[model samples]
Target: MRKTALYPGTFDPITNGHFDIIERALRLFDEVIIAVAISQDKKPMFSLDERIEMTKEAVKSLSNVTVVGFDNLTVELAKAHNASIIIRGLRAVSDFEYELQLGYLNNSLDDTIETVYLMPKLQNAFVSSSIVRNLLKFNGKTDHILPKEVQKIIGNMTSCTLH
Candidate 1:
């Protein structure tokens, strides 16, 4: 059987930590779908098209990875992609509480689907989209924490553009 996993997130701007999780997920699944969520409540800095483009560019070298956008529940997205597993990245203990709840909720939504948690490299553990956004907002250097393509997008943007 072909094993497929779905990794869904807003990915306002894909970060190195998110990239790290994608790389690691590729090792365990035949195809890992990077689902960029069209979040309704949270307004993202980048448009969905921009997020998808940046994510595609960031993972262009990985043949087994695919980037797509979704505006539905993650479990529904997983089912649509024929994925039996949902991959969530765990950064710290604080992340676990929310992730655990999400895992249970998703599992309840679709009993056959399973949620898997993966941790990025320790160096990337501290990096997150919100942090990167804050860094960019203050003109703090975020090149070290973001992917090249993402860096370029933020590099060209003024603080006013983010809002």
Candidate 2:
């Protein structure tokens, strides 16, 4: 049976770090689904459509990878996608406790589904959606942290000059 993994995140703008995890996940699973969450807890800087478009553009070159959107329990979404594994990216020690709690909760909710954590390449490890969004908010450079396509889109979106 083909093993599918679900990598769920808000991916408000899809940073290069996210690309690192997705690429690495591909080597371990038959298919990796980039599940963009339509999160209710946090207000995203970019719309769901924007997040999906950015992710699609970033991952278009990858094979055995698909992108989709969801707004329900992650385990339920995984079941809907026929995925048995959940991919989580760990960037720092600070992320561990929270992620561990999530893992425990997810497992409790559905023991059939397993969660795996992968770390991004060191250079990209510090890059995150919130950081990228904050950089854009301050008109800071994001060329080094975001995918080229995403950088272009975010550049266009934030390039408003007050006359």
lDDT tens per residue, model 1, 40-85: 6788878899889989988998888999998888988898899999
Report RMSD (Å) for each prediction in the order shown.
Answer: 1.4, 2.3
Residue 73, model 2: Cα distance from true site in angstroms: 0.3
List residue ranges in candidate 2 displaced over 4 A. Answer: 158-163
Q: What TM-score do all the candidates reach, one by one?
A: 0.95, 0.95
lDDT of 2 at 79: 97
TM-score of model 2 vs. true structure: 0.95
Q: Give stretches of model 1 more than 4 Å off.
A: 157-160
lDDT by residue for model 2 (1-163), tens: 9999999999988999999999999999999999999986788887898899999988989999999999899999999999999999999999999999999999999999999999999999899999988887787898999999887776676545411
lDDT of 1: 0.90
